[model samples]
Target: MELRVTNLACARGGLTVLEGVSFTLRPGHALVLRGPNGIGKTTALRTLCGLQPALAGEVSVPPESMAYAAHADGLKATLTVTENLAFWAAVYGTDLVEDALQRMNLDALRDRMAANLSAGQKRRLGLARLLVTGRPIWVLDEPTVSLDAASVALFAGVIRAHLAAGGMALIATHIDLGLDEAEILDLGPFKARSPRDGGPASAFDEAFT
Candidate 1:
């Protein structure tokens, strides 16, 4: 599947957060969204994931094929790791079984409550949810936030494997994702105007000029 964003913009409380962001992500590849803090990276991901509305422009993808993981590790505190995985598996129709737990080194922590897991472990569990989710396209915001070196390497390996297997991802991160061939959409160093109360301008309008 292919995911495309064209001139995407969003407003929060009358402030324009993202302005005319555009990119295309295809299977076997990835797109890294880079920008300074408060530049709407998270908001952009949220809009793409349907958590927020797109005040302007378009996000084109099959709803069923998209999966989104936010910066906040959205695990239920009372649920066991395994139970959380089961819930996501049932929701997203992922069939990863034991392989995913082994990959994230969570087999031992599987029975532990999500509330007690360390920050890094919780992040890993969140990623493992992605592995079990059968979505073809992933929208990940700060995917490796609290991971250690070894866990980061493991996450990179898993991501590479995913791309090699014809999956696609759009990651918003400040750190290197270790994907050598990934496309980098650097929003920084761009002379972007802060959006007015109405929202940002559309890039498509200039496409005809």
Candidate 2:
């Protein structure tokens, strides 16, 4: 199924921040969201993922088909690496836990508690959750946070593989992920005319939630 956003308006803090936003991501394709900070990139992604409502316009996608990853990695401090992945696998009714661990290079730390892993490792584990979801669409916001250059390249390869496997991705990031086939959508022209707080934030403080 294709992910379509038509004349989408994204609002944050009860005010419209992005209007007339439109895009369509087909299978095996990627769309990158581009704009300055607080320009509603995360808000748009959240709306597409049904985490929040859209002020206007429409979003069309298959039901229960999206996996969202944002600034919050959604890690359980008490759970071991394997346990965390297996839990998500159970939730999504998939048995790709071992593949997720290997793809994210967490096999060595599988028995370790998430709290014991470093920041980059935690991020990788969080990303591994996507693999178990078996969802067709990935809506990610700044997915490269805390990743070193090598890890960034590693994740990029994972994304490329996902795309190659007929998956779609909608990412909001400032870093170049080296996906030459991915299309870029600049949210600047779609900026809302309404006044905003003009702060250095893109959405509510939902990190670690």
Candidate 3:
């Protein structure tokens, strides 16, 4: 299966920020989005996950085929690392909680409450959710936000393994992941022009401008 975004247009606050964005991600491949802040990288990703409707174009992927990880760690502070993974695994109907714990190096911290884990450790735990998801497409937004160099490398290895196993990832990150299966897509050229440049600006557009 492949994830195809064709002539896509994504908006935020009712103002289009990216237009004519397109790419194809086949299994065992990954695509990294590159752009300045507010260029709609997250907007594009959110649209793909059905968090918001695309202003135009189409995204073709199987239903329930994507897993999204944003800034939120999505952890319950009261739960231990193992319990948290178990919770997500149960939600996703998977039995890979133990495996996720092992891969994320949380085996020792399994009994520790999420509130007690370090920021990087918590990020690792949150990303571990992807493992139990059983989804082929991973749509991540700045996934390395609080990770240290070593932790970033650890997570990159996880992503590499996922790609090697016929999975696809669409990541919006500033860090260079150095994955051989990856390609880059710059959203600069797709930046939306001001509505006033083409037509009268809508009141909503004026607020953002």
Candidate 4:
């Protein structure tokens, strides 16, 4: 499967944040979005995942084949780790909870309540949800937020396995994810200029360009 974006424009709260964004991600590949905070990296990912509409241009990717994990882990505090994966598995019509548990190295803690897991463990559980979804495209936002060195290595291994199996991923992160040969999409060039910075000539402008 391929994710193609052409001249995409994104806005938040009626303000344009990114414009003329475009990229193509093919099977077995990954794209890392890099930029400073508030540069619309999240907005672009949201647009790609269909959580929000793009203000302009086109995004072509099958929704059914995509799985998105936001910055928040989104785990139910009262549920066991296994239960959480099972719940998501049922929702996605897949039964890979056992495999996901083992893949994320959460087998020992599988029966523990999500509330009892450390931040890193919870993040791993959140990532494991992607495995159960049976989707080919993974959209992750700051996936390594709380992971230590070993945990980050583990996550990288999982991503590598996915790509080896012809899966694609689009990730937005400030830290290096250690994915070998991953394409980079820096969002800096796409940042929209503020009107006060002489972006476009307007009647209200004291000095029009």
Candidate 5:
């Protein structure tokens, strides 16, 4: 699936957080969003997913083709891992819940309550949720956060496989994700705007080779 965002803008409480941001995403390629803290990285992802309303511009994506994984854990703490996956599978109209869990090496913890898992385990579980959706375009925010060395390598491997299989990813992260062919979209140098009474921001178009 191909995803495109044209002149995407967002305003929060009458303040413009992002403006005139445009980019095109193609299948089998990954785009890494590089920006410092509070630079509308999360806001951009939210706008792309329609979680945050765009003030102006176009975000074109098929309803089932796009998925967004936020920085926070999206699982219910009371539910077991398997239960969570089952719910996601039902919502996404997919029966790949079990397969996704197994691929993430979470089969052993399938029966364990989400609250009992460690932070990294919870992050993995969150990732597992996205995988179960089987969406072609994944907009991931800080996917490697709180992960140790081994888990980071595991994630890289998973992403590599995903790309090889013709899936696309848009990732916002400060750490190196080990994607060899990824195009970097650095969001720095855009004049920061205060959240109060919003100002239009210049779109970030400085692509890295």
Candidate 6:
């Protein structure tokens, strides 16, 4: 699978936040979005996943081929770890719950309720959902939050396995995920200049001129 973005512009709440962002990610590759807070990394990820619309430019990636994991862990509190994986498997028409469990090192906690899991465990379960989706592309936002050093290494291994299998990932994070070959896209250059700053012109304004 190939994801291509060209001169992409993103906005939130009717205000432009990023503009002129472009990148191409092919199968077996990863692209990391790096920048300070409020620079539109999350907005860019949301736009790519079709949760939000781009203000301008183009993004070419099939909706069905993408799996997205946001910062929040979207697990059912009452469901067991295994049950949560099974539920997502049903939704995505996949039967890889056991595979996901093992990949995320959650096999031991499979029978435990999500409510009883720690923050790191919940984050791992959230990540395991991406594997069971069977999609070729993954878009993750702040995926490593709440993870310990060991858990971070485990997550990195999972990402490596995904790439080795010809899957692609687009991640927005501040921490090092240990993915040496992944391309870095610093969103600072693309951050929208505030209209109040009296800069030459906002990227959004320049786009139309």
The model with the greatest TM-score is: 3
Q: Residue 145 deviation, candidate 6, in Å?
A: 0.6
Model 5 CA lDDT for position 45? 83
- 1-209 per-residue lDDT for model 5 (tens digits): 58888877775554566667878888888999987787788877887887767778897885467788887878999999999999998999899887878778899999999999999999999988877788888889999887898888888778888888899999999889889858998766442464233543333321221
Instruction: Point out where model 1 deviates above 4 Å.
Output: 189-192, 195-209
Rank by TM-score, descending? Answer: 3, 4, 6, 2, 5, 1
Estimate every model's Cα lDDT from 0 to 1: 0.81, 0.90, 0.91, 0.89, 0.81, 0.91
RMSD of 4: 2.9
Q: Candidate 6's residue-wise lDDT over 143-196, tens digit each?
A: 999999999999999999999999999999888988976999999999877766
Q: Quick one: RMSD of model 5? A: 6.4
Once fitted onto the true fold, the runs of candidate 3 whose alpha carbons sit more than 4 angstroms away are 206-209
Summarize candidate 3's per-residue lDDT along 76-193 as a digit string, tens digits.
9999999999999999999999889888888999999999999999999999999999899999999998899988998999999999999999999999988889899999999988
lDDT of 3: 0.91
Cα-lDDT of candidate 4: 0.89
The residue pairs in collision within model 4 are none
Better of 3 and 4 by lDDT: 3
lDDT of 6 at 195: 64
Model 2 C-alpha lDDT per residue in residues 1-209, reported as the tens digit of each score:
89888999878887678889988899999999999998889998898888888888998884489999989889889999999999999999999999999999999999999999999999999999999999999989999999999999999999999999999999999999999869999999999874234433444433422
The digit string of per-residue lDDT tens for model 4 on 95-150 reads: 89999999999999989999999999999999999999999999999998889899
Worst 10-residue lDDT window for candidate 5 reads: 200-209
For every candidate structure, what is the RMSD over all alpha carbons to the true structure, in angstroms? 5.6, 5.7, 1.7, 2.9, 6.4, 3.6
